[model samples]
Target: MQWIEIVVLALIQGLTEFLPVSSSAHLLLVPLFTDWPDQGLAFDIAVHFGSLLAVIFYFRDDLIKLTRAWVGSIVGSGMNQEARLGWAIIWATVPVGIAGLLAKGIIETSMRSGYFMGYSLIMFGLLLGYADWRYQRKFSANPASANSDEYHLSKTQIAVIGFSQALALIPGTSRSGITITAALLMGVNREASARFSFLLSIPVIVLATMLQSVELVAEPLPVGWGKLLAATAISALSAYLCIRVFLALIRRIGMQPFVLYRLLLGAYLLYCFY
Candidate 1:
């Protein structure tokens, strides 16, 4: 990819990664529409790493507190709220990690193919819209006034959300979208679901990026390190800003706008590709 293409792709990756709009779908569709060369495994790994850094930086203090609390709990001290949250995140990551490992090849072969991109877009868009509708109805009927602590998810709920995340292997099924949908279905409030979803993403993204890096190292691409570094830097900066903006928007307008956007994007993809 040219430098300009790299910048555009990185920006797209950063923005969509946290925006509930499916970063994978945008990456695939943007390249298709723009006539850019496929950003192969190396580029993908770089972008993921960039977003990983963004999240880490954004939540540094919370992460430190959680880690310390978790360690203390392990040594027989009473766990604090942050420590319990840390444990919940750990529990929620398991299903996705295992599913990603087992289905890695299958997902790569099937969903990542350009042929399936349009289908994924339409299908997952409808699913997200349905989920949002259900969540809105339930919330309107009996609003949740409880805080995160009060609605702390059980292990079963975590497992279910984690398993739902596996569906996000498809290009249009945003990881946050699917997991938040699961959490909402399980009765967690929207903001709490979103918060936990963001926290849960740290480990999963880190491990997946590491695995992708290993694959890239096994067979170095034609691109040089300078290009990789530039791409990653741009992506990281963009992702950081994206996450901030998304969180603000969620607090203000809720997720309905995102649901509408997904549906329209999906329809556009179907029209263009099918």
Candidate 2:
């Protein structure tokens, strides 16, 4: 790949991976529009691994605390909030994992159509916008009433969000977007909803990378080693910065900005493909 293609695609993967804007949709559409050849699974794995590391690095402190608490609880130590949250994250990842396994063939074969991607982009965008508006209105009436504890997701909420995550298998139903939208519609605060959505990503990315790695074990090396390294570095840096900025931005603006972006992007894609 040319340097320009490397940079653009890597940046797109990094920037959209965490946001509710659907990284998969952007990745899919870019080559479609630009007439570039598919990046192939090897390069896809490399960039994804980069984004995975970015999320893990950014949340290192929280992961450490959650890990220690979770491990301690397993050993019969007193359970705490972080420990419970840790287990909740594990429980919540199950639905998506199962869905990925069961639907992998169908999703890969039939769900990559641009028409479906466009529809999901528009429909999910409107739903997300409505959820954000509803949340703001409901919270504004008694903004001072919520304590920090209310942000932590209940068991039922986690299950609901987990189930919703399976929708991400569709071409434009972004994993982060669907998960965050579900959390918000279910009454999670913006920051907490984003936090959980990102946390849920860790296991999913790891599983995906491992699965791809198995396929790559016998394949010829993809691209030059040097190019792969450069792409990985770019992916990591871009993704880390994207996560930081997105989290900070959501605190200030809620999800409306991203929702608007999705709406415009969907409409443009529909025009192009439909």
Candidate 3:
């Protein structure tokens, strides 16, 4: 890939990764539209690592507390604030982890097909729109108590959210978008849902990136080190900014705008494909 392509891909990866717009969809579409060379598994892993760093940096303090709490909880110590939250996160991750392992081959095949990609974009975009609308109604009808524990995600809720996350195995069905939708549907406050969704992403992304990196080392891509470094830097910088902007936006306006954007983008992709 040229320097320009690297920059563009990195920017897109960073921005969409957290924006509730599917990063996988954008990664596939951007290259298709721009005629850039295939961004092989190595580049994909590198960009994901960039985003992983952005999230870790953004939530450094929270992570430290959560890790300590989780370790304590594992040893049968009394649960603390961070431990409770950490357990909730682990509970949420279980379903996705199992599902991803079982369906890896099927998911890979679907991602390789443009038709499945277009269909998923349109379908999930509509799902997000409906979810946003429904969540608005729930919040307006009965707002959550201020004193309610923000870290609490019931076992059922975690399972439901995890099931929703499995949908993200589809190319255009974003992990963030689907998880947020599930949380909203389960009566989680929009801001809280988005926050949790982001937190939940760290483990999955890190594991996936590491595995992909190993694969890349075993069978190197055609690209060089220069291209890889440039892509990683661009992805990290843009991802940091995108996380900041997205968190602010969710606070201010909820997820409706992102839902609308997803819908429109999905429609355009469908139109092009059809």
Candidate 4:
């Protein structure tokens, strides 16, 4: 791949990976817009692997606590808040894992059409907007309402959010967007929802990378490793920056901007595709 192509695709993958915007949508649209060659599954895996690193490093401290707590709970040690939270992340990832496995073939073929992207973008975007609106109203009525001790998600609520994440299997549905929308719909505070969405991404991304790694192993070797490494580094940096800025903005802005952006993007896709 060319330098510019590598840079643009890497940045796009990294930047949108954490955002409510769907990175898969952006990637699929790239060739449509620019007529670039298929970056291939190997490149996709590399860039996503970079994003995994970004999330891991960004949440290193939290991961340590969660890991320790989770391990403790496994050996009959008393489960604490962190341990329970750890388990919550695990449970939340299961639905998507299974869905992705069952639907992977169909998703990569028939589901790749722009028609699917347009509808999913608009539908899920509206859902996200509604959730944010409701969240704002509740927050206005009772400041720190979501912060109340009783506001944490129950098991049923977690299950609901987990199942909703499977919707992100569609190209434009956006894993983070769907998960955050689920959190907001369940009355989770914006910051907390964003945090949980990011946490939930760990296992999902790891699983995706593992699957792609198997494919990468079977493909040609040593041909593009240098370019792949460079792209991975770029993706990591971009993802890290996006996570930091998104967390900061989400706390204050409450996702209105993203909702608007999604609506506009969805509309454009509909016009272009249909």
lDDT of each: 0.78, 0.86, 0.80, 0.88
TM-score of each: 0.91, 0.95, 0.93, 0.96
Stretches of candidate 3 exceeding 4 Å from the true structure: 145-150, 220-223
- Candidate closest to the true structure, highest TM-score: 4
Indicate the worst ten consecutive residues by lDDT in candidate 2.
Answer: 144-153
Candidate 2, residue 84: how far the Cα is off, in Å: 0.8
Residue 19 error, candidate 3, Å: 1.3
The per-residue C-alpha lDDT of model 2 at residue 71 equals 99
Writing each residue's lDDT as its tens digit, candidate 2 over 23-78 gives: 97788778566978887777888789889999999999999999999999999998
Model 4: lowest-lDDT 10 consecutive positions:
144-153
Of the candidates numbered 2 and 4, which has the greater TM-score value? 4
Global lDDT for candidate 2? 0.86
How do these models rank on lDDT, best leading?
Answer: 4, 2, 3, 1
Model 3's alpha-carbon lDDT is 0.80
For model 4, residues 54-104, the per-residue Cα lDDT tens digits are 999999999999899999999988988888888898888899999999999
Q: Which predicted model would earn the best lDDT?
A: 4
Off by over 4 Å in 2: 145-151, 221-223
Better of 1 and 2 by lDDT: 2
Q: Rank by TM-score, descending?
A: 4, 2, 3, 1
